[model samples]
Target: MDTPTEVLHRVFGYDSFRAGQQEIIEHVVAGGDALVLMPTGGGKSLCYQIPALVRPGVGVVVSPLIALMQDQVDALTALGVRAGFLNSTQDFAERQQVESAFLAGELDLLYLAPERLRVEATVRLLAKGEISVFAIDEAHCVSQWGHDFRPDYLALSELRELWPEVPRIALTATATPATHAEISSRLGLDGARHFVASFDRPNIQYRIAPKSEPKRQLLEFLRTEHQGDAGIVYCMSRASVEKIAAFLVDNGVDAVPYHAGLDSRTRAAHQAQFLREEGLVVVATIAFGMGIDKPDVRFVAHLDLPKSVEGYYQETGRAGRDGLPATAWMAYGLQDVVQQRKLLTEGDEAHRRRQALHLDAMLALCETVGCRRVMLLDYFGQQGSEPCGNCDTCQAPPESWDGTVPAQKVLSAVLRLKRERRQKFGVGQIVDILLGKQTAKVLQHGHESLTVFGVGTELGNAEWHGVVRQLLAQGLLAVEADYGALVLTDASGDVLRGQRQVPLRRDAPRPLRAKTAAAAKSRPAAELPQEAAPVFERLRAWRAATAKEQGVPAYVIFHDSTLREIATLAPSTLEELATVNGVGENKLAKYGEQVLEALTA
Candidate 1:
């Protein structure tokens, strides 16, 4: 029998385990239960996969996304692993074949959706076969308070009840301390050993820009920083997804729209295209990207704000999964704050409170003047991290000035409007009043004569809007649920009096589009030596054709990282090619000669 390290190199083409992987694998192989909190792209799959291969029976994987099961199986199959999935998408005959393989002990791993376990037939089917281990991927979904809660995951605790002897491992890419505890409790893994990996992804540079013609800003960001790269653009609404996708396509980008609103077939086709093709961008709502295994996504841009810091981290974590430099960018503004606040009003008191806490944490991250990475890590209960010079704040530190006077000016304007005029207004009117703009709305209200009007002319219209946004973020200003008009919070009293000093972050002038630290560290083929570029392109072309022929993603044949190593080494023999990191035995024996021919030609 092959050992785990040997199996790692022979099948998956890695020379050694990533940090914290070896110990976890050893324990699971020894029949111990574990809960793993590793970040995305941290080789969480290998922790369970190697143990499954070395153990006696098929590993039963409980996955959340049935739609992605085929791609997952395809990826493993390319490595010469006998992998099969039983999901609703498969026909009865297809399910029967996988079942037979499982029963015959011919399959290495069998993937199933969590809901499938509720079926009595599926339970009986599992009872008929031996299970080496149970891996619950995306285990954070079991947390009722988490961003992506799936009711089906709550039933996963029964796995331990049914198969008391089969060791289980639950894995997730994002979880806070609270969510971690909840996962343990809900999944009945409280006694299971826990391994929490560092949540930092230094390859991703975090950036948040104040929204200014956001679609245009997104387009400029794409064209300038991430041209000809695979990316995901997240929007809060389906309409925004469609409009942004169309806008990008119109502006000479190869982009597609993905949301729950699309038909299943259309969504699948778009997802397949994104995985198979290069330089494609998918503009999607939050529904699109939970289990995406694509590793080359260079950037994740948010056109609107995410509700929670955990959700934001989870979404941005999807980028730079290959450990190459990538970007986590967002366009945030006053309306995003208001919209999210309004959303919190729905649901029960407990639900509203939980969502409010989430929103508050997210707002704090957006408004933070320190390192975005540090704030992100702190939210996940990791501390003592020095400034990561890759985030926008660290790269270009913003000035924080005493905004107490400006705060008073803005608050006075709102106060006067309410107490004197018995009227309320949203941000636009408030900013106009602050700037002393004699717009029709102001004149119709009959008087630019308020004491606070024109007091804020020391700042530009944009600057006044920034003050309002910051005040809202700081909780001194609240949005009325009925009409989103500015209302004062209990915290507003201190600033209204002279008792509080409000220090606010000044929005820096937009910098020139130049190579950021993250961009400079990127190792794309474009950065390869001049001679190797063409060879890399040739290999990419060959791989594309082969993937099309085999009906699988190009990465399944070989990752771009592996090909880059091959292009750099210019290996002349199969022996030399096998030395590459991702060149496994199966791939070497299958495509070794063709790779050499492609390199030489």
Candidate 2:
């Protein structure tokens, strides 16, 4: 049996395990259960893949997404692992072949969707086979409260009951304390050893801007920050996904949309192109991005507010997976909060309250004046060190000014309008009254003779909006169910009485500094030296052609990161090339000669 370290290099082509990976692997290899909470691109796959390889029988991996299973099998096969997947996508004949292989014990890992496990036949087949560990990927899907809940995943807990002897490992890329606890309980892994890695992705620069003409802002950001790079643009709705995708394509960008509304074939084709092609942008809804394993995603831009900080982190974590410099940019505003609130109103009271809390956490992250990384990490029950210099706040610290007076004025306007005038208005109306705008609604409400009237004229409409958002985020204000009127919460009285001081981030779009811009434009290290550039391109061309011929994503042949390593090292012999990270035994054996020939050519 290959030790975990030996398998790490010989199969996965890594010199060492990432933090917490080795320990988790060892625990699983020793037939112990584990629950791993690592960030996206944090090598969560290896914790199971390696253990599966070292263990005796095939590791049964339960993934939630069919697309994910296909990609996982393809990548693992490329690494010389006998991996196969049985999902709805396969034909009857294909399914038979995989089943035969499984029964014959010719497979090391088998990826199955949770729905497949519900079938009695499938469960009985596994019972007859010599099973190894049971690995559940995206374990958070078991949490009914999570953003990406799948009913199919709920059926997975049966595995623990059916095969209690087989060790189980549940893994997820993002989970909060509550969600973490729920995952453990739901997956029947409550007693499993827990390994929680740092939630920070330091390579991803986090930036959130107040939404104003979001399309225009997104276009400018793409042109300036991510030109000729592969990325994802997340929109709140399918309509916006289609519109933005069309707009991007019209502007000479290679972009496509992916949403739940689209047919599965269309979604699959678009996703395949995104994985195989370089510099393609997929404008998508939250329906996308659960099991994406792309390593070189340069950025993830959110065109609207995510439901929660966990959702936001998972979506943005898709970028910089290769441990390269990347970006997490978002555009949000008061409207996002209102829209989310309206959405929650449709659910049951308990569900609505839970969603409201999640939204509040997300809003607080956006409205915070401090470091975004720190705020984001803190939400996930992790303590962050000094401000991460990679985020927008750390890059160009937002101007913070005393917002106490403005907050008081905003809250006073809300309270007076509700109590004395017997009127409840939206945030816009409140801001209009505060900014002294004598709009028709304000005029109809009678002369603005209130003490707070015109008192906030020192701030413009936009500035006042910022103050209101901050107050809402800080719990100083709340939106009453009565016509969505802003109401003063108990916390508001402290600020109104001068007992609390509010600090608001006066956020403005700071032009990308030349240094930052250059860093943003920096390519993978393999493309840096002039000599290696041509070689890197050559290797990419070869990989692309091979992938096209094989009908698999190019990354399956060799990830860009791996090709870059090969290019930089310029290994002239097969033996020398084998030493490059990501050059696993199977890939090296299959492509070593061709790789060396490309370098010489």
Candidate 3:
């Protein structure tokens, strides 16, 4: 029997285990349950993969997405580990073959969707076999309060009842304290040992700019900071995705659109291209980028605000998986906050408050004057100190001004409208009244007579918008669900009566060209050295060809980081090449000669 360390170094090719990984593996290998919370690129897979290999029998992994399962199987196969998956994509014959392999003890790992466990035949088959352990990936999906809730995952709790002795491991990249508690209870792993790692992705530089011509801002970000690099441009709607994809293509970027609206064939084809090719952009909606195994995404740009901080963290975590520098950029404004409030308002009353809280947390992160990383980590219940130098705030701290007067004006307007007119007004009407714009609504509502009218005329529309947003984030303002009207909260009274002060981030005027140029200078170039350029390209060509022949993503063959290391090191023999970070025993044995030849050429 191979030991866990032997399997880690030999099969996965890592010299040492990451923090919290070996302990989890040891706990599970000893037939104990565990719940692991690690960041996206923090090597969560090793925690379960090593235990599965070291334990007695075959490991069954419950994954959510078909694409994710296929990618896992391909990567495991590349490591010379016998792995198979059964999904809707497979025919009966293929399914039967995998089942036979499992029954005959010829497979090391088998991947299945959570829904498959509900079938009597599948459950019986698993009961008939000797199973080492059960691993639930994306375990946060089991929590209804989680951003990505999967109904099928709720059925997974039955596993504890069915196989009481088999150890189980639940792993996720994003989970709050509440989310952690819910996952443990729902999955029947409340007594399991809990392992929570730091949620900070220091490699990703967090940037949030006010949304002014968002498409233009996104294009500037891409052109200046990430030219010729692989990235994901996320839009809130499918129409926006289509428009942006076309616009990028027209502007000389090789890009594709992906969303649930597209047919399966088209989505799969576009996903394949994005996975197999280099320097391609995937313009997608929230429907995409869950468990996408691509390791070298250079950036994740949000054209709109994500609904929650959990969603934003998970999406941005997709980039910089190779532990290299990456960027997380977003352009959001007041409209996003309003739209998200509307969503929460229309949701079920049971979940409405929780959803609103999540949105507020997201807004706080965006409007925060402190380090973005600190705010983000704090949301997940992790204490973060020392402003990370990678984020936009740390790089160029935003100036803060005493916003007490602005807060008074906004709150007084809300009060006067409610007390005198007996009506609630949305942000647009409030803005109009503040600016003394006697429009049709203003005239109809007789808001011109209000004492707060024109009190904020000195500030521009954008500045007032900023004030309103900051107020909401600070809990001084609340949005009425039914009419999207802004209302003053109990906390607003203090600010209105001069008992409290509000400090808001001052929106400084920045020249587009100068800002873009500075950002471009800040970003590192994604290029190989002059002398190693030829070898890198050749290695990439070889990877592309090999992936095409095997019908898998190129990254599954070898990550770009590994290829660059090979090109730079110019390893003349298999033994020297084995020292590379990604060169595990199986990979070295399988591709050693070919890698050496490529380096030579």
Q: Give the winner by TM-score.
A: 1
TM-score, candidate number 2: 0.94
lDDT of 3 by residue, 67-138 (tens): 667778889999988899888888999999999999999888989989899888999899888899999999
- In the predicted model 1, the residue pairs found to clash are none
Clashes of each: 0, 0, 0
Off by over 4 Å in 3: 438-447, 480-483, 508-530
Q: Candidate 1: worst 10 consecutive residues by lDDT?
A: 514-523
- Stretches off by above 4 angstroms in model 2 are 448-451, 480-484, 493-500, 514-522, 525-527
| lDDT of every model, 2 decimals | 0.91, 0.85, 0.87
Among the numbered candidates, top lDDT falls to 1
Screening candidate 2 with a backbone cut-off below 3 angstroms (N, C-alpha, C), the clashing residue pairs are none
How many clashes show up in model 1?
Answer: 0
- How much does candidate 3 score in TM-score? 0.94
RMSD of 1: 1.9
Query: In model 1, which regions exceed 4 Å deviation?
Result: 516-523
Per-residue lDDT of candidate 1, residues 325-429 (tens digit):
888999999889989888887999999999999999999999888999999998888999999988888878888999999999888888899999999899899
lDDT of 3: 0.87
Residue 445 of model 3 has an lDDT of 75
TM-score of each: 0.97, 0.94, 0.94
User: Residue 443 of candidate 3: its Cα lDDT?
Assistant: 88
